[model samples]
Target chain A: MSALALFQVVSLFLMAVGFYGIAFRRSFVGMLICVELLLNGAGLGIVAAGQLTEANPVLAQLSTLLVMGLAAAEACLVLAIIIVVAKRWKSVDPSVVSELKG
Target chain B: MQTSALVLFVIHALIIGVGGIMAVASRSLVRALVGLIMTLFGVSGMYLLLNAPFIALMQLLIYVGAVVILIFFAIMLTKAPAGGEEERPNQVRTYLLALMAGVLPTFVIGWVVLTDQPASINAPLETGLKALGQGLMEPYFLAFELISVVLLVAMSAAVILAFKRRQSR
Candidate 1:
């Protein structure tokens, strides 16, 4: 495999692992961790594409920067939600924290 | 790719792959967090390989330094069970479903990447911090400004959510 393809594959691996974690892990925090992996995968793929392709490199890095910022913002909000959920529901499991379950 | 570079790339890829699996599959949340740190570190190495050192450093600072610490705080605050007592006898179906869901996308994307190879352009190596800064300041100024606004809003929202929870109790 070419270097670029290898990097892309690794990023895909990260994304797959993240999806599995999100679907299978019961804890909200674990899902959040997995989300991080997914975002990292996205950023890596973007950079790899820019690096190897004819795409504008600066724009690629810029996009990755935005992704990082968004990840940070998302992490902040999710962590806060987890705290609030823990306080109110007394459990961090998604099933236990459900109030709209029919 | 040179022989040395290929070796380095393989090492970093292994780190990311192993760390990703560990982060997802570990029983303990703390161990999962550790695995996530490893993955972040490996990604930064990838950024270095891709000739984006500034992004690599930022990845180290923002992801490994800040986000991981934030997660650690959350883990400490929640103090959930150390991955025990939540198992059910009928969870095999759910596990298989999740595995399929994850693997399907990987295979589809992998096939596309392998078959549709992007033509590599021998562009000048100007992916330095200076270029990044100029791009952010010039053409991407609106986006740069908007990102700060987004971050500010997110920070305030997080603070409000936490404080409101405290006041409710």
Candidate 2:
């Protein structure tokens, strides 16, 4: 495989790892960490795709920046919500914090 | 040249794999967060290898600086008893669903990679701060402003959600 292709493969592996964490993590904070991993994986994929496609480098970088910003905003919002839930339920375990579940 | 790239790929893959395992398997939330940070760092390295320095930097700034810190604060403020009842799969069906959720994306991505011939990597890194600024303020200017508004709304909402009950009490 080419260098770029190799990078892409590694990126995908990271993405998979992140997904696995997201699937299995029990705590909300742990899941949030996994989400960060997933977002990073996506960012890496975008960068690799941009490298492979020289046609629009600027666009790719801009999108990557946007993703980063979005991830930051998302983390802030989710963390705040998680804190609120923990405050009320006294637990971060999703299994137990099911008051809203139908 | 190819050999060096392959080595880097192997190293990055190992980092991601180990970090992923640590993040998922560890019992401590803080340790899991650390593992996640390591995994993100590996991804940023991969981005650098892909020749997008700006994106890599953003990865560092946003994921490492902002997101990870947010998680840390959550862990600190929340009173969740660490190392409580082991997180068991609540049901067989849920376990199966989770497994499917994890496997489906991997298959889709694998199919795309295997079927599509690897594209050539001839593009030199063209993203500099100037170009990024130009694009952010130009064609995507409206979207950029919109994102700022979205962020404002999200921040205020988060603050309100987190503190509303406290103030009421």
Candidate 3:
């Protein structure tokens, strides 16, 4: 297999790892970390596709940039939510957070 | 395909794989954060291998520098910085679930990746950078500006949410 394909596989694995983390992680922040992992896997996939394929490489780089920007915004908001949740619920575990259960 | 490049790629792959495993498998929040940093650095190295120095630098600066620091502070603020993170019930079942959830997609996607045809686009090296500049300056300009607005809104909303939560004490 080509190196590109291998890299793509690695990215796919990262996404899976992230998905698993999301599925099982008890804490909200752990889930958030998993989300970041998912995003990074996607960004890496885009970058790798651009590098390997003859398609518009700029598209990949630009998308990765956008992903990075979005990730920053997401981290900011999620951290704030974690702080609020921690204060209100006195626990960061998502399993314990059930105020939205309707 | 040089030997040196192959060696570097091997090093990077090990870093990414091990770090990712540790990030998810470890129970400690601090250890997980450390693993995440290691994974991101490996990712940045991959970006360098992909020939996008600018993106690599951005990954290092934004993810490694800003984002991780923010997470660390959040951990401290949330009272879970050092350890004592809660593990969910049915540890064996969760492990089984995680394995199933992770492995299935990897298998499916790996098959497709192995069978897919190669890409056929042929753009010059410098042109990619040029196109990015044009995109930012023209077609993508509005989106770029909107991103700033989104950041502003998110910042304000986060502050408000935290303030409201604080006030109800």
Candidate 4:
């Protein structure tokens, strides 16, 4: 396989790992960590495609930057919510904090 | 690929893989954060290998510096537990289910990628801070400005949410 393909495989594997973590982790913070991993994997795939494919180089860079912005915003908002949930429930376990379940 | 480039790729991949494992599997929250930082660093190095130095720098600065710190602070302030629960007795069944759920789509994607080789773009990245700046301002100005606004909104929302929650208690 070419180097680019190898990198693509690595990023895909990372995404899979992140998915596993999201499902397996018992705590909200751990799931948050997995979410970051998934985001990074997406960024990596974009960077690789930009570097390897015939598409505009700036396009990938721009999209990756946008993804970074999204990630930052997501992190801030989710962490805040996590804090609120912890405050109300006195725990970070998603299973325990599900108060509004139908 | 040049021998040196190949070596660097191997190194970066190893770093990323190991760091990813530590981040996902570690029981301690702080240790998981450390692993995530290592993974981000490796990703930046991959960006360097891709000839996007600016992206690499931004990745290091934004992800490693800002995001990591934010998560760390959240964990610290919340005093979240260090270790999560141990794998339950039905761990194998759950693992199989999760594996099946995660791997199916990935297999389809991998098949498509293997079958359809994307057209390769061999143009060297125009490597100049000025050019990138101009590109961002000229064609992507709307996105640039919008991201700033989005960030501001996110900051305000976080502050309001946290503050309101604290007050309500």
- Which one wins on TM-score? 1
Ranking by DockQ: 1, 4, 2, 3
Considering every candidate listed, which one attains the maximal DockQ?
1
Candidate 4 C-alpha error for residue B84, in Å:
4.6
For model 4, what is the error of residue A33's alpha carbon versus the real structure, in angstroms, after optimal superposition?
A: 0.8
Candidate structures ordered by lDDT, highest first: 1, 4, 3, 2
Q: Score the docking of each candidate (DockQ).
A: 0.71, 0.62, 0.61, 0.63
Residue-level lDDT of model 4, residues A1-102, one tens digit each, is 766687788788778878887887777778888899989999999988878877777878888999999999999998899888888888777778766898
Instruction: Please provide TM-scores computed only on chain A for all of the candidate models, following their numbering.
Output: 0.96, 0.92, 0.94, 0.95
lDDT tens readout by residue for model 1, B18-93? 8998898778889999999999999999898888888899999999989999999988999866664234333789
Error of 4 at B160 (Å): 0.3
Which of the numbered candidates is closest to the native, going by highest lDDT? 1
Who is ahead in DockQ, 1 or 3? Answer: 1
TM per candidate comes to 0.94, 0.88, 0.91, 0.92
- Which residue pairs in model 2 clash with each other? none
Off-target runs (Cα >4 Å) in candidate 1 are B84-90, B121-126, B165-169
